[model samples]
Structure formats: structure tokens, C-alpha cells
Target: METKIQKWGNSLAIRIPKSFAKEAKLDYNTEVEMTIEEERLIIKPVKYKKYKLSDLLKEITKHNIHKEIDTGQAQGKELL
Candidate 1:
């Protein structure tokens, strides 16, 4: 489980073993957050909340819904 830091272009990189990556649920192109603690580096997945249509609709109510605004007739060529 020991791996050396290799030079990746101008930055140093460490390879995460397949077994560790699989256990951490890390995949190709997966968003991750990296943070450094007192003496350790922490890497975690950046999980985003997926919103549903019904869940979004619930946020719109009479108190917060916008009313239709009446703009005067357009004088320019708007028929097209």
C-alpha cells in the first residue's frame, strides 16, 4: 500500500490504489474536495444535491411567487 510521490508535469502527484479508490467511491472525473489538516491531507467527494421537479415546485408559493408585469405595447418591429 506504499507508493512514492511521482512528478506529474510541474506538480507532485500520488496514485490512489484501485482498492482504496473503489472503497472511497472515487471514479473517473468525480468531483473531490481536498483539504489539509494539522499533518494530514483529506480528500472527500463533493456531493451535490440533485433537485427534483416536485421538490423545486414546493419552494414556489403565493408569498414568494412573482406576479405578471404589464409592459406597454412595443413600438419597434416585434411581429417577427
Candidate 2:
């Protein structure tokens, strides 16, 4: 697919064809990551980050097992 960079307000934008957008699952407000490699530029949707509960717990435990509790900071806060 070929696209032309056109002027928009103060930025340059590319008009992607509907067919290409649909095949790539592109939509309004979709978050994308852009990168350049060699002589090519790449654009891809940003994937959600995943975390395993067990792995997170293990990391926290390793770093904070013997940490002192800060009771003063937690005492007067009203959590909404």
C-alpha cells in the first residue's frame, strides 16, 4: 500500500486505506508504536502489557521481605 504524507493543522499525517486499516485492525484512537530500522519505518499497534501474579509477588517478596513498615505515612491518609 502507498500513502502520501499530507499536512494537518500543524502536523503531517498519512491517510491509510480503509482496506489496509481493516486488515490490520486499525481504528480511531488506536495506540501505535513507530520505529525506524535501516531504511524502513514501521508502525504497529501497542500491545497491552501482561504480568503474572506469581512472578510479581515473587519480585516484591524478594525486594521487601524484611523492609520496615512506614506506619506514620499510612495513618492519616483518607483514601477515596
What is the lDDT of every predicted structure here?
Answer: 0.91, 0.82
The TM-score, computed over Cα atoms with residue i paired to residue i, of candidate 1 is 0.69
Q: How do the predictions measure up, each by TM-score?
A: 0.69, 0.67
Q: What global local distance difference test value does model 1 have?
A: 0.91
What ranges in model 2 sit over 4 Å off? 61-66, 71-80
lDDT of 2 by residue, 1-80 (tens): 56689999999888988887888888999999989999787888889979999987878756468777665544455554
Query: Candidate 1: worst 10 consecutive residues by lDDT?
Result: 70-79
- At residue 47, candidate 2 shows an lDDT of 95
Steric overlap count per candidate? 0, 0
